[model samples]
Target: MRPGYGHTLRYLGAARGAITRRQPIFPTCYGDALQGSPVADITADPQSGWTGVHPAILAMNCLAYDAATLGNHEFNFGLPWLTRMLSAARHPVTCANLKLTCGRFLPPYLLLDRMIRSHDGEKHPIRIGIIGLVPPQVTSWDHLHLGDRLISEDMVKASRELVPRIREEGADLIVALAHTGIDTGPAHPFMENAALQIAAVPGVDALLAGHSHQIFPDSTVPGTDGGAVDSAIGTLSGTPAVMAGFGGSHLGILDLALRRHHGHWTITGHRSEARPVTSMKTGIAAAPDAEISRALTKTHAATLRLTRRPIGHSPAPLHSYLAMVGDSAALRLVNAAQHEAMAELLRGTAHENLPILSATAPFKAGGRGGPGHYTDIPAGPLKLRHAADLYIFPNTLCGLQITGALLRDWLERAASCFNRIGPDARGVPLLNPEMPSHDFDVISGLTYRIDLSQPARHAPGGALASPGATRIRDLRHAGKPVRASDVFILATNSYRAYGGGGYPDLPDTERIHTGKTQVRDVLVRHIRSRSQVAPPAGVTWSFASQPGASAILETGPGVRRHAAELAALGATDLGGGSGGFVRLHLPFDGPLASRGNDN
Candidate 1:
């Protein structure tokens, strides 16, 4: 969830209001109800709903018990809003691992004890120590808002210090609400993650794991150390770990079985599962939680009005074509916006004499985004929230001067997003399911073709030969090859400009310029100024030279029809074994060194 993704404050306030009014207290779930739909559209809130504190806090409040830890997406709103949200939480928000720049916990870990009813109908008091830990990546991704107020501490050291102390306080259960993810891929610290490490901590009974947004293959994951077990309810370090799915799509429930033996407690059994917010296997339905909605209605209204004000109109829905092989309506629009905005920024920079271009990866396109990733806005007014939906990241506009050689290498990285799949493929392909939304490419200002026959210069290595190569073959300028020495002024987000995605060339540029406006603002300005938007003129590509070309080649019927017309002219859909594309390389015959002054 983003900074204010939940209506947590309002939900808490409403719950408090109910308590003051002496009314029956039944919590209502906020946001969209899961009713067996594509996971992409599971939590569609155009404005006030999931964009801010509403979703995160609403979900946090729903699983009300004690303190909950913050996650990376929590900083999407920056520190001020996060602080405000944390301050407003009914229960103390604790994270011992995080230190402010002043060297102190934002909210110290709490020594909490509560009374519970045992299965035998006996009342028992249990001392439970809770500590929350958020991912430090927030400092890099959302630095604009965080400034210097927030700093993340080492998770291992934080757990190490707090464990013995909690036990000394006579606590029976040590619960770590770790926002870091677990090992979904291979089991390594970089891959397997610290959830296992946190679970292996002495005196820690259970671990509450969040952030990765995944389901455990089994209820119990063994700890690195013997005599310890990691369960969904809590980690064997002491207890199990549970993570409610993003946007309230699921409520993670961990039931722990504890038995008293010789006046001491022992965990008997435990289990955990992601209870879908809505059951879609049956049909689409509204399983709205009226109470939570009503509580947050006022706050949700203000946030929506603040963020969703219409900027312009679109003839068709501006949707994203994320992972699929075609440009999305929304992504194309953003690409056009970035292309235009970057060109303008370049014109004012020292590299104005060089050919200027802009490119952005479709971060929120396809993959886990599901079918809802498509940008299909009806012919209607456009709003800031709509723009937010188009460009989800809070990235700043940055420009770099890179030679065509480096530019090609960068494109190679973008092309690596695809993987080779065949009928006889073994197990799951090396393709990482969690390559992050922003890694997918959607280019503008330049047209190129990707050849899957070559290999990718993927991470930790430069380039190696492999049958599973993703290379740009027919990269064109006007109607010919782009010279190796061609200097291109590229406009991109600061994330890439600073080498965040391992695109080191962007940061090593000789000339770097940071723009005042954000990418989304530029897009909003572009749309409002245009007043009317149209579908892309045309974009195409091809890859039929490979072995498995025919089976892998496909596009929407609309694109296929256009391809047929293009094919009738001279372009044959080259049957490539990996995949096929309708070639759309525009002709740029302008002078190589033409400057804005000359124009």
Candidate 2:
């Protein structure tokens, strides 16, 4: 339910309108209903982060939804802010595993009473139950806002505890509004994607998965075939399930066939599939519902005004097509903005004497978002929209005190995003496809080398896979080797400081400061202070030399304009690939050399 952005909400209304025209439906959103990427942080009210409440909630109510669940992104602002947004939900927006610091407060599940007509036209009384659960990672992902103030229980554990209660309440059918992806693997504690396990929980009748942003029941999606998941018919562990594509692209539909047996309700058969609002593949679309556009016009106008506000100017083109491989001007801008603000705050503090480093990640790189997702800001005046592109999340500013030993470990975790490429290897995929681009944070104030020839020390989950493994080489600070005992004050978002994206678990005592000001606010300030900004072209890190070794790196098709930068790093363009991506043949054939200003 994107409000401030494009007509995705209108398309959502279109999907709802078309579906309901055939028959009445119990529409349920898995999560992330109130915001879209980039402009997602934009709220209806500036103080409220806008919450998308005016249109998101208003439109949800208009669509006549029975129930909706909270997504992990819902917690991005804070619990208090989220509470206010949820209060306006005309339909119940529930979350089972969420609770107040004091005790269980948010209702874990919701029940609905309705009359159902059987195939023979027999009307019977029925009670439907919905259990909502967000990813367990939210506790770590948004720990700064969730810490001590709220508690998030693991999804499967909470389901085991709450399912029986729903059954005892006389519910004939139960639907799991799981705001997590379907992972066919065996269940474990704190698993971020656990829909398959949730469906396996006894008494669970159906499941709806989200957060992965991929359509389930699509055979093209890996892990769906030859497993507990049956994508052809959209069943998980024999339970009807569907995961609608993300960003209001599709609507999931699950039809259940039920019959009365011995005075009890039983589900006999089921089918499920996702209906797309518009598809480039098939070139089909649902017409935009005019009511939603009319209802949201006022907010949309304000959004346009907000987006066009000026911030600063760019000296040259800044894009993230090359962010993952080498020096990225886009990322450098974010780090420079962060470094300046945190530096000012630390000036009068006790930890001011320590050298400062900024941790930043690439958010818009081409991955799950497809080839058009990478940031490409041409040289011109910077606006709020450009700033939003630089920093997608509405995370708060946080600073932590860390020893050099921990800093080295942090890089090891980030380095795991790449796949192991042995010496003299050629044409291997440089990145682990499962590794999200946002998790690959590169420290701005250091020079290091990533030896892809070595196995990753840390696994994608941020756990130590090999105790003695090392991928980061020649780690340095201020042109010298960093000692284990030496300390540094790190400038980062609250998400990273609290172990978001599986970086590390830092103790609360290590938190030197937690500023209420949003990181974007500081970035705006940093940009406005400068007449024109141009981040250094040099990179902070480089891949260790592997003569005769080349790897495949795909970026947005916009890479055609930056051919000169490609030559500097000894890379060649391989033209376009399916899904609008431009592939690159990055050859690590040259000798390793020093990079960036920190050196």
In terms of TM-score, the best-performing candidate is 2
Question: Could you tell me every candidate's TM-score relative to the true structure?
Answer: 0.72, 0.90
What tens-digit string does per-residue lDDT give for candidate 1 at 492-589?
77656655554653333454676546677788788888858763554523332333222222222223334433333232343321112222221111
Q: lDDT per model, in order? A: 0.52, 0.76
Q: Could you give candidate 2's per-residue lDDT for residues 115-165 as a string of tens digits?
A: 665544455677888899998778776876677677778899999999999
In candidate 2, which residue ranges exceed 4 Å CA deviation? 1-24, 36-40, 44-53, 137-140, 183-186, 224-226, 282-287, 590-599
Q: What is the C-alpha local distance difference test score of candidate 2? A: 0.76
TM-score of 2: 0.90
Instruction: Give me the candidate number with maximum lDDT.
Output: 2
Cα error of candidate 1 at position 396, Å: 2.8
